[model samples]
Target chain A: MKKRTILGVRACTWVWLIMMGLTLVTYLIGQLGLGGISASLTVLAFALIKGQMLGDYFMGLKRISGFWRWPVVIWLFLPGGLISVAFTLVG
Target chain B: MQAQAVAEPIRYPPGDLAIWVFILAELAAFGAFFGAYAFTRMQHVELFNHFQATLDRDAALINTFALITSSYFVVRAVASIRDNNSQGCVRWLMAALVMGALFLIVKAQEYAHHIDEGIRLSTNTFYMFYLSLTFFHFMHVIMGMVILAAVAVKAKRGGYSATEHTGVETGASYWHMVDLVWLILFPLVYVMK
Candidate 1:
């Protein structure tokens, strides 16, 4: 195995573990029935964090040190912000 | 006098630029749908809340884990291919495919239950968004499976190498996109109160 491949595998393993932990945490938060504005924002925050991890690690965006990084970040915030706003207004 | 030299940037997007374009388009479409869902929910807060209560949160939670685990498996598959281990890559991808199949089976059962309960697309605004968003995502999962299956078959046939495994990366990128969508969709549609 190449050196880079070894390093890549190790990095991805750690990211995957973190993502799983976050998923469980998000589910537990939802189960708390913290309804209304706070719950919505917190859930959206979890969604954004998970999505960013997938993009950076699994999608290999973190390796790229150019303008390519911004697109994924923008992609995450756009919908997240919109949903947050909607939830707040409805509440 | 001597001319000065400059170094080029040392970064490139993963898999293929074409796929990133496709990923962006898919995300945009989903974002629009989610925005619309939020808008519709705001307009009919009571209706959305009442029907949202009817959704199977347990099933959604289970599906969430399935996708997250599958995504991890895909990462492993990509790592295997990166090391030029074709057989290992195939095995990892096959495992991911099984998880994807599990997701589809669970989703199919959920759909069956809805159908049995006479929950059509026109049932209500909430159900409309529910069925539309989830079923849309359901199809994406199947599509991602097909892509992964192809990658796995190619890898099994020794079509990829450490230096030329872009196919595996491409498929992994699309699969991760599917997982990303579900990560957001699960909370917005299922867990949000």
Candidate 2:
């Protein structure tokens, strides 16, 4: 149990670090004033990945099974897809 | 050798099942709002782009980092409770609370800047969405923090154990959702052109 706890903590810490780095990258991309289709797509993709990491790892959804698994994926892709489409239309 | 009990598939939906329903409803609301924002943006592309420039991207970025870190700390708190480390869990939850507070502070500053600039929900379509969406999310952050504080207080009283700590996971789930919403919100509003 102790070993598992230690490993879990380590894994979470690593995930946190990765998320922080990705956020910095996202910030840089946004600050560069990336506009239009490609830019929106790129940022939205990053957002999707980041949101997935949080839901799957941080929320521990990855460890579970059954119908619970799909909501996170749906949540990410649905609004994300809609927003992406919206950006494309406007961009 | 004793036969091992047959393994069963894990149940769907984590935490309280009720929370999933609430989460779905909340997502739907936000989705509708995002769609509306996008539709409105399409109608007034020039105006949306123009006002988007006036937003403090830097502050939004800081708030983003804050929420992400808060979610991470919530993960740690849940992990600690799963290990029956009540004190450790409390510490992590408190740390997360600090991050949540930091998020609110930064958001407040952004709001102050906007208010000083005569921004309000009635300002325009863009400002309308900006203020409504962000402030609605801002309130969620506060609510998430309150939930964390309650969980932390309970943990401090040794209200959980290794075999039973659903509250921690429940609070963490909500916090993660809050973080997740911002992940979409930031790009859609602050970054997407």
Candidate DockQ values, in order, are: 0.66, 0.71
RMSD of each: 3.6, 2.0
Q: Evaluate all candidate structures by whole-model CA lDDT and list the values in order.
A: 0.87, 0.85
Best by lDDT: 1
Q: Which candidate is the best by DockQ?
A: 2
Instruction: Flag clash pairs in model 2.
Output: A68-B13
How many clashes show up per model? 0, 1
What is candidate 2's local distance difference test score?
A: 0.85
| lDDT by residue for model 1 (B78-182), tens | 888888889999999999999999999989999999999999999988998999999999999999999999999999999999999989999999999999999
Two-chain DockQ for model 1: 0.66
The prediction achieving the highest TM-score against the true structure is 2
| Candidate 1 segments whose C-alpha is farther than 4 A from its true place | A1-9, B1-10
Candidate 2 per-residue lDDT, tens place, B1-193, comes to: 9989987777754477777788878878887888788878989888998999898889888889999998988888888888889999999999999999999999999999898988888889999999999999999899889989999999999999998988888888888999989988998888878
